[model samples]
Target: MTKDSSPTQLTHFDQQGQAHMVDVAAKQDTHRTAIACGVIRMKAETLAIITEGTAKKGDVLGIARIAAIMAAKRTSDLIPLCHPLALTRVHVDFSITTETNTIQCQAQVETVGKTGVEMEALTAVQVGLLTIYDMCKAVDRGMVMSDIRVLEKHGGKSGDWVSLIDQQDHN
Candidate 1:
């Protein structure tokens, strides 16, 4: 699709309006990468427990990282219309901000395939935050997850795209 194409165009729908996987067979295989990020905020005390490794559950960040990677690999299985692609790499990282009592999860998913890895990266972030909440819910049930989004994406017919929030940071 070109940049001039209708913004409302839904690639997953056919002329009959039936949901179907977009035909990517004609698309070239390229090195596609997608970076997604999100943050989960909690009480100061809960953050302290996590940072100090005093939570009843073992390492919170470690478990969440593993869950994020697993979620990336199984993205197609979870999302009905996603095409299954062999991911070349899945990297999940977490950063804790004591001042805000928040943990940020970033996932970068890459693949050489007809389509992009945006969905996989996004799935990883969501699952990672969910895992963190699961591990720490006992201590802080009010933990809030926000700012979930694809930071950037590269390759594919549409070419590279970066979220305006990230672009502004570079400038």
Candidate 2:
């Protein structure tokens, strides 16, 4: 490949700068996985409402879990540059921290495809957190979403990559 056609160049644009899908047909399929995380900070009372399962909208975590899975599957529809992928596995997790008055959302997405699933994982985490906000917004509209990021990814030519921030927190 010529230096002009290096993969580092933007993949979502053609020579004319028009938008187009990156062709992955020639790329080898590999087992790809990505994990993303984010947090929603809210009032303590709002957190109590969610924890007690009395938000009037029913179960906050349950609804958020479903939303995250659905969002991961429909990622291509939401993000124009993302490719439609047949995901093999998708998991969404949530934790509530009283100290921070925060709800943390994490999503792990896996697929055997040519492209990475970082976008899918990130989308899932974001949608999951949004669902929480929507369900609890009636009681608390001041909630803030922050630290949305990909925690890790593996497979493809890039191999494995992990976020140092997440690692440090765990340690």
Report lDDT (CA) for all predictions: 0.94, 0.94
Candidate 1 — which residues are off by over 4 angstroms? Answer: 1-7, 169-171
User: Measured by TM-score, how close is model 1 to the native structure?
Assistant: 0.94
Taking the tens digit of each residue's C-alpha lDDT, what string does model 2 give over 1-171? 222465577878877888998888878899999999999999999999989888899999999999999999999999998999999999999999999999999999999999999999999999999999999888899999999999999998779999999889999
Q: Which residue pairs clash within candidate 2?
A: none
Candidate achieving the largest TM-score: 1
lDDT of 1: 0.94
Give per-model TM-scores: 0.94, 0.93
lDDT of candidate 1 at residue 30, scale 0 to 100: 95
* Deviating ranges (above 4 Å) for candidate 2: 1-8
